[model samples]
Target: MANIIILGAGIGGMSAAYEIRDAIGKEHAITVVGDGPVFNFTPSNPWLAVGWRKPDEIRLNVTEPLESRNIRFVPTRANKVVAEANRLDLVDGSSLNYDYLVITTGPRLAFERVPGSGPEGFTQSVCTGPHAEKAWLSYEEFLKKPGPVVVGALQGASCFGPAYEFAMILDTDLRRRKLRDRVPMTFVTSEPYIGHMGLGGIGDSKGLLESEMRQRHIKWISNARVTSVEQGKINAEQLDEQSAVLKTHELPFSYSMFIPPFAGVDAVQGIEGLTNPGGFILIDEHQCNPTFPNIFAAGVCVAIPPVEVTPVPTGAPKTGLMIESMVTAIANNLRDVLAGKPMKARATWNAMCLADMGDSGFAFIALPQIPPRNVTKAMSGKWVHLAKVAYEKYFLRKMRKGKADPIYETYVMKAFGIDRLKLEENID
Candidate 1:
C-alpha cells in the first residue's frame, strides 16, 4: 500500500485528505502534517478583526475530525523538503518518507518586504486567527482615541478580498459606535483601479465597488506602493500607467492594516524544479509537479501568474472555490494514477468570492479564473452578506464531519449552472 502524505492542514490540506480517503479507501495509509492542531477559517478573519466574530467561532481542533476519519495527524513543523528522496525533514529532527506528497501549505505573509509593517511593526493583520484577535485588541484601543485609518494591499499581494472586507467592516463598526465622524479612512492599493482585484475586474466590479466606497465615504489611492510605514505615518508612491511615480503621499493614521505580499513557506523554497522563484509549487493543468510527478499542490501555495501586468506588481488570487476544485482534481488524479490509468482530471480553476462589507456584501464568479473567460458575474446586496454568514457555519460543519463534498458542485454549480471539472477522458 502507498503512503500518501499531505502537508499543511489548512483548508486545502484538510479537504484533500478527506477527498483522497473517500477516493482511495482504507487500503492505503493517509497522513496529514500541519504546523498546529487547530484549523482557522481564514475567510472569517475580517469579521473577527472587527469584533463581528469571536476566535473560538472560527477556530477548530482538526485533530479529532481527521483522526476520526482514520487519517494520521502530525502536529509539527517541517524543516525542509527533500524532493529527490520523496522525504520530508521535520523540525523535531524526525523524517517521514512517502510514496506521494501533496503540498497545501499556504503563503507565508511577507511582512518583512515592507519595513515597519505587520503585527510586530506598526500595522495590524488578519491573515491568521491570532493575528485577527490581536487586531481586535488594537482596534478596541484605537476606538478610545479614533483617528485616521488606512487599509489596503501592498505591492505583490495576491489576496485582495479580505483587505476590502476589513475596510468596510471597520467603517460599519465605527458608524454603529457613533465614532465614524472622528475617523478618516483611506484605501491604498497596488491594483490599477478600485476593483481590478488582480483578475482585471469582473463584470462591472469596478463601478460597483467604486460606488460602494463613495457612498461609504471611504477615500482611495490606486496604483500605490507602500515605501515605508512608521508608528503613525505611512509613505507611499503612486505610480502612473507607465510605471513612473506620479506622486508621493505621507499619510498619517491611528489605525492601519495592509495585506502584505505572499511567498512560499521556508520548508519548500529553493528546491530545483519543485517551486518557482517565489517559492510557490509549480504545477501543470493536472496539479502535478512537472519534474516530480509524485508531488502535487493546491491553494495559495501553487504558482499562478498575474492575469495581466500592472504598473505596480500584483498577483492573481486563488479563491476558495478555485482551491476546492484543485483539491478535487488532485484526489481524483491520484486515484487514477494508482489504478494504472492515465491522469485525466483537471481543475476548473473557477473563482468565486463573497466579500462581506458588514451591512452588505459583494459576490463574484469568474469561470476559469483567467482572462478571456467564458463567464463573469458580479453583484452586491444585503443577501450576499447573509449568505456569507451561513457559509461560514456550513463550511465549519463540513470540516468537523470530515465530509468530502465538493462545495462548488453542491451549491455554486447548481446555482450558476457550471461544471466543477474539465476532463479530457471519461472516468467512472
Candidate 2:
C-alpha cells in the first residue's frame, strides 16, 4: 500500500487528500499535516474583516471528517522535508516516513518584508480567519471615530484581488454609515495601473476599475514601493523605471491593510532542486517537480512567472478553478504511477474571479489570465455577491458532510463554456 503524506489542510491541501484517496482506494494510507485543525475559507476573509460574518461562521473543524476517511490528522507545523529520505519532521519533534509527499502548504504571508507591516498589536491583516477577526474588531472601534484609511498590496505581492475587494467593501459600508466623507480613503499599491490586478487588466478592466473608483470617490496611488510604515504614515518611493529615479512621498492614514508578498512554506523552501529563489516550490507545467518525481505542488506555494512587468511587477493570483485543475493533474499523475500506467499532464487553464464589493460584486473571466486573450470579461451585479455567499455555505456543508465531490469541475467548465475541452485534452 502507498503511504502518502499531504501537507496543509487548506482548500488545495484538503482537495488533494480527497482526490488522492478516492483514486488510490482504501489500501493506501493518507495523512494530512497542517498548522491548525480549522479550515478557513480565505476568500471570505474580507467580509469577515468588515464585520459582515462572525468568526464562528467562517471556520470549520477538519478533524472529524478526515478521521471518518481513516486519514490521520497531524495538527502541527511541518518543520522540514527530508526529500532524499522521503520523510517529514514536525515542529513538535514528531516524524513520519512516506512513499509519496504532496506539499500543498499554501503561501506564507511575508509581512515582515515591509517594515511595520505587522506586529499583531499594531498593523492588522485580513489574510486569515483569526487575523480577520482581529481586524473586524479594530474596524468596529475605528468606525466609532473616523480617520484616514489605507489599503493596497505591496511590492512582489501576487494576491491583489482581496485588497481591492476589501477596499470597496469598506467604502460601501462607510457610505451606508454616512462616514464616507469623514474618512479619507487612499489605495496604495505596487501595480502600475488601477486595474492591473496582476493579469494586466483583463479586457477593459483598467478603464472599468478606475471609473468605478472615481464614481465611489476613492483615491489611488500606484507604482509605489512602500519602504516602511509608521503609526500614522507610510513612506513610499515612486519610481520611473525608464529614467531610474526614486521619488519619496509620505501618506498618512489612521488604519491600513496591506497584502504581503508570498513565499513558500518553510518545509519546502531552500531544499535543493525543490524551490525557487523566492522560496516558492519549483514545478513544471505538469505541476510536478522535475527533480523529485514523487513530489507535487499546488496552490500559492507553487511558482508562476508574472505575465507582465509594470513600474512595479504584478503577478497573477491562482484562483480556485486554476488550483482545482492543478489538483486534478497531480492526482491523475499519481494514479498512473501507482497503477503502472503512463502519466498525462493537463494544460494550464484560465481563471474566473468573483470579487465581492459588499452589497454587490464583480465577475471576471480571462482566457489566459493575461492580456491578449480570446475572451476577457468583467461585469458588476448584486447576484455575484449573493452567489459568493451561497458558494461558501455550500462548500462548508459539503466538507462537514465529508463528501468531496468533483462537482467543482463541472461548475468551472460551465462558467467558461469549455466542458468539451476536457474531452479534447483527455489522454485515455
Best by TM-score: 1
Q: Rate the local accuracy (lDDT) of all candidates.
A: 0.91, 0.81
Error (Å) of candidate 2 at residue 412 is 3.6
lDDT of 1 at 52: 85
lDDT by residue (tens digit), candidate 2, 1-428: 89999888988888888888887888889999999899898888998998888877878889998988888899899999988889999999989999888888888888888888863534678788888988888898898888999899988889888988999999999999999999988898888888778887776777878887888888988888888988888888877765254688788888888888887777887888988888888887778888887788888888888888677766678887677778878888888888998778663556668788888877777776666666667777787787778777877787787756553453344433446464234311
lDDT string, candidate 1, 96-197, tens digits: 999999999999999999999999999999998899999999998999999999999999999999999999999999999999999999999999999999
Provide the TM-score for each candidate, comma-separated. Answer: 0.96, 0.94
What does candidate 1 score on TM? 0.96
402 in model 1: Cα distance from truth in Å?
2.3
Native RMSD of candidate 2 (Å):
2.6
User: Where does candidate 1 stray beyond 4 Å?
Assistant: 410-428
Best by lDDT: 1
Candidate 1, residue 385: CA error in Å? 0.5
